[model samples]
Target: MAQPRKPASRGSRRGRKPTSCTQCHLRKQKCDRNQPCNRCLQRGVAHLCGDSINSNGGFKHSQSPQVVSIAPPSPSPRPRRVTQPPMSPSLGTLFANRGARAFYGSSYFGHQVASRILSEEGQDLPAGISRGRDTLQSFRDESSSFAQVWDLLGLLPRQKSTVDRLVNIFLAEVNWSLDAVHEATFRSSYDEFWGRRFGFDDLANVDLRWLGLLFIILAFGVLLDSPPHPTLDVQREREEASLRFYWAARRAIVIAPSFYGESTDIVRAGLLVTRYLLYTRRVSESWLTIGFASRMAQAQGMHVDGERWRMTRKATEQRRRLWSHIYTIDRMISLALGRPYAINNQFCLTHEPENVWLDDMDDEEANRAVPQPLSLPTPSVLSSLLYRLAQVVGKIQEKCFGMERASYEAVLQLDANLVRWSEQLPPYFRLDNPDTAADDALPFLPWHRLYLHTSFHFARIVLHRPFLLRESITDRFRTSHEACMSSALADLKIRLRTMNSTNADSLRWAFGAHNLFNSAMILGIIAVKNPHSAQAGAILEDLEAYCENLHQDPWLNEFGMAELKVVELCISKAKDSRYTSMTAYPSGTPPEPPGPRIQAVDGSGRMRPSDLESPAMSSDMSSIYWPTVWEDGQFTFPGAADFSTWEQMITGIAEDNYGGQ
Candidate 1:
């Protein structure tokens, strides 16, 4: 065996100097060595342009890039013991360079993350795919990124029946919740593809971006199969195939730069992709993806009024619809992550979408419809309702989750505003007025009801979640806490029942598995905190049903079933205690209230459990043995704040590609 070579000393004299940036020099390429240097600017890692102590063991230029390394790069390209490849930079070392070392100075740290990623990927980069090359160019080959997606998912079957069936499934299952693309447009595209191609060889008829969108739609059709067909092996196979296509679509989009263009296709795909990422519980990645879609919308001026751009009436409506979806996604993700909204309201002036869905418009007449006066506004009741929710979500983030802590009075005012919002909603959309719902709107009534209710309850959760950290609830804050519990119970009750019901349907809906997941968690904690309550049995049942609904989803399988089992077991123990008491003292008499007296950590006095066996009812807890909301069995379920590390890395590429906010 050979010994490792000693690193060269900085004072050592070296050979002839190289004329390249540190990145270029490290990769053995020519460098323009401009301010950001050609390679750094090309890779959009311009901020990472500083020269390291170059291989010559001396400063190459006075205008050296400010980047610092853990230590100098190995003097020679290959270490003395060439049998094994050297390790790329360690995570701790990269973080240190970015944080304490302040690698980028005043520039955003997003690029630092990308540079480190390319550094780590250095060992495997192909000869033509240089590290400092354009970021998009480097990602042109995504086979590794989407290894599971290489196989065709049969999204475009030759049989018209099969294509129709899958299309129906997507439309029937998730369309209401996502309403991502116009159904008419989607079917037309599907028809065009199936009519022409039985394989990839004839796929030229479909645009790469649209093909990607089609794959996602098919994947969602399989992934969103609720109350799945119990006896069908084919359904299972399709699901497996759908996931492969979904990931392949993900990979394909990254490979096709045109997919990111500021057009409806990219915006639709981005929104749906973000939604799919979130549903699969890829919460952090969803946040990152939504940022891309949001920027794309901004680039297309979707954030501004159509009149300002001189767009046609139909074009304006399409822009509004796209903007609405992006805005909702933005709010949902920001709230889910407890982060600030990426779209600054000060810069946004796009009007809310009108009552007309694109499906209702005739393409020929759509142009003529643009001249209608804005004063006679009739909103897309469902879309507009969701848009309002997004607005509230934005404020909730700012007033509640932002740098400032809202006062008791401020919280109360916001609560009142939420209530007022529901009151002002169109009568038919209100939960209380289903009997008066329009005949044509009946198809979507249940969805709207649930959506309206979920928004109210979820908002309540955000508003009072802070109370859990408080040592005590004061008189002013007492109502707010009560409201939180009340809304949570209400949110769970309707959501669980509607989702489980045979008749439930929505034409264009918001709120589903994602909402239910959170709802189950809130209810579980409430049941655990007050375990002896009469409602405990129902709470456990709700959790059981939620688990069933989510079990079919591969990405959610681990957290979904595992979290349910934990909640069920805890509640079961309490139920057993209750049964024992009832057996001791028969029916007519009051048996001893069941379960431990463990009050959950509600941010007030109940920080820790009252005693050991009982713990805080938190889905986000670090462990199942302790108190956890939803944890991976492998002990790696990303906590709400735990995703912070990935947040930077995930969004890093967006900064490089989209050129930052």
Candidate 2:
């Protein structure tokens, strides 16, 4: 029978938001109200809301219905049973039981049994399989116990530990690959992958300025920690490898189209790579690295010309003073390498203006002034490059032969050449401009300083040689010394005058002061050897006064102070030492002296020597005095001196003992 409808109460008739289902509301308890209220629907209970069945057995209806009524039907119930299909085994169970048992269970059996079965079933199984099976069986027999197998499994190392152990191996592999790439690209070595592909061409296409600096650093690093190669050929091969890697990394930096901040990583990597190349003696490649970097800077809106590949006037002129310094470094390197002056050989500077006047040119003028075919300049950066190269070469020579006669001679030759070349540089070459004022004259002190230091060191080597007096080399050395000193002094005077000028705050002026003082010290040392040379003494006094002035000044650098002290020590030694001269013998006379004669014994048992007298000498003896054997007509100063005393003086100066920190 269907259920009858229930009548709604007056309160229920009012409109309100439904909080719960009608069945739950009627039950008056919390309900989830999923499909039906649990209490009402689960119990199959249908109760009226505060109402009873009508007398006519008909559903009662109210103004608003609380619930719908249903008619009750006669019960004729019969339940039916349903059968379900079987489920298949899961993948995990299948793999664990069937697959594992098949593979591992047979292996646990003796290899004899397994091999016999394999032989019967297989047509041509690999011979190694029997060995593998035997090993597996042995392992299984050994670890038969559950606890043993469990412990063995637990004893295995973790993934993290394994990864840590392989980290160095991975890094070494990467380095090797990068080096191979580098060799193929820049060193003209045949690295199959790098050579066939044009991977490094992009890197080569980058600006040269950046590449030059980077290459130097790289070559320097390699040279410092030379590769473990038996021969020069192998070493060169490895170096070329390093170069290719550097180029690739640089190429990556250039092509990376991203924000400046994002590109820093690439730039930093390129810098590090280039530094390594430079440390390796791959100087040519290093220059290329610098070129690339300069291009990159230009590409980033730095105004660099691609054809004559150099930074624009506006960009470089701001740092124009650095040009001399850059030029000096390049020159030094070329000299050290014993290569002909090829400015564009390793690095390109076609974009740099020929004249300083171009720096101030207007746009229209600059456009017209730009040369049709940019000619490469001479090796202008030789000085600074030579300075750095000397340091590197000195280290190399020291390792090969410490204070060897041959090494010293070679050093002297280089020094002599440097001085000669520097002197030969025309005044116009030194002068940045025709109208450059006396105060603004290009400082020659740096050139003089470099010359004097190199020369003095060369002189020390000469004086230290045991056979210098016997050898004809001394004459050649003396001549070179005079030439170097005279020219150095002339340049020194100009530098000193410039330093004393009012515009001393200028970078050139400051450098002039430093170079002047430094050159004076070197000259002072040279003078000590030639104390009789009036010019030498005058220069020494001038140097001393300069040092004193520096001590008074409050702005000298620590390095400058140290150098000054070295000069002072050289001067003090020169003043205190006694000068001696080597005597020249007549060309035809026998070089050997007369032998000493033995006298007859006077005693009977033991032989006793009697005083021997020479044959009667002439009453009138002519005494002949010759000029002292001055090195090139200059006195020789003792090469050995405690340079530490000078070091201390400089230290005191640096520490502000003179209130000039």
Candidate 3:
């Protein structure tokens, strides 16, 4: 082998002429000595092309185009050694490059996750096509006339009574969950904003961040204040009005160019926008917005504990509250999409917010404020509790979905950790225990408790979902199956009860819809696979109730209908023997359908006999009579359900796109 070339000495290169442009010189590539060199053009950095570095290692700029003499190659020089092809940049690099413009669909997880889980049982349903286009079109139509000049205050409700009602509704019914805006701060600012409403020196003097946040709050008020069991026309009116305010918030951001700023209100507005998008089933858009909000929060150093900077106690508390909520929402969107979370817990030094009531908090007098304990029932405990759970969820995402197949040991460990997290919950927040501290409780507490448990159970389902297959239902993995099933059942039952309760309006949010959809899917699979089992029968009943409740929800859109079809399809499969025989394959012969592909990371490989074995995984599965598709003691279950195809079929019917296929 030829020895590596020796380093050139300083004296040897002192008189040597430059051979490349600055861009090429830095990359150490052979460049043709043109104004914009061949290497610079090839590397897509032609704009950065300049004179090569001097012997002193300083780069020189050629003000005008250069005409340098090209050096001739020496006769019979040794050829350069061949090198390996360049590797593609990692995901971190792609995301971190601020100059790069990526155009992947914003909604990464909502439908993709549903498609994956539904695909694994036996069929590939059509992936839910995004509704982002129609949403954008509506936005453009609504904002077009006002694009040049929006009277920011003109977007507000004309009547003071209406404004007061909306503001009061938001502070009372909605603020508990978000805790993004401080009530005291907002009230003071609201008075100041109206007092100077007409005194702005043009729109530039307006507080765009505050204006955006106000619009978002008003949007939430319109959205959440709907009467129970609203009619389609009423729902349409409410949605339009809500969108109007939401759009105004977006326009405020555009005017302020808030993406370039680090204002907390802008971040707050972005978070609220994310939640609103989810409510409209614009899941991809929500994902994109939340990601941008996460970056904005990081830019403000919100991920770091504020106390370290010697900020006022109230400011520190506010930062903690905002950061925790951001982290919570980030994990939620990530988990729902089956994607990696934005904020890593290891690097996040901010602690959970104290359970201090908004009334007790005073930015100027934090010394007098007394925070409620974790065991006490307080509105401030909501985000703090959610952050604790999000930490566990972050671990679950890494251990299970992070690998092709999580180790059985890893699954059990994560499940234990999750159970411990649930066990440590205060009695007021616990599902099994009743809230005795109702003396100072908010009306939303009951709904809040259910919401937290819904998330907790959802995490359990995701963690144990891989080991939930019937083939993997041995004694060692039996707990995993039970945990998954129980969590799904519990989730559906809770949703059903909530729907029937007097507080039925509380279940109108997107998180509830997403969780309910996921649980229904899991139960649907159980019903199909074990059609004759009493457990399957119970699951079917709950699934039907869920469907009925879903129909009553004003937020139901195409995606909602798609979810309905998913459960309906599962029900149809269990009840119709003809469909079953037509769809099902013989034992050992799994069919290859041209549908949405199943993810290998979903624990498909781990179910095989060769991949996992335990003393409990004996030949005798006599008690359970769900028809076996395994052949020769190998996992070979056919993919009988095509969720993407089925969804496409349903959507085609709805849109009349199939031409009577």
TM per candidate = 0.60, 0.33, 0.64
Candidate number of the best TM-score: 3
Q: By descending TM-score, how would the candidates be arranged?
A: 3, 1, 2
Angstrom error at residue 496, model 1: 3.4
Off by over 4 Å in 1: 1-161, 168-177, 187-206, 223-228, 232-235, 258-260, 357-359, 362-379, 433-441, 468-474, 501-517, 532-556, 573-661
lDDT of 3: 0.61
Residues 290-347, candidate 3: write the lDDT tens digits: 8877876776678878786666787777778778777877887776666667787676
Cα lDDT for residue 653, candidate 2: 23
Report lDDT per candidate: 0.55, 0.35, 0.61
Which predicted model would earn the best lDDT?
Answer: 3
lDDT of 1 by residue, 294-363 (tens): 8756756677888677766766787787788788778877776776677988998878877664556776
Error of 3 at 396 (Å): 1.4
- Per-model root-mean-square deviation over C-alphas: 16.9, 30.6, 18.8
Better of 1 and 2 by TM-score: 1
Q: Model 3 off-target regions past 4 Å?
A: 1-154, 157-161, 197-200, 225-231, 258-260, 363-365, 368-371, 436-440, 500-504, 507-517, 577-661
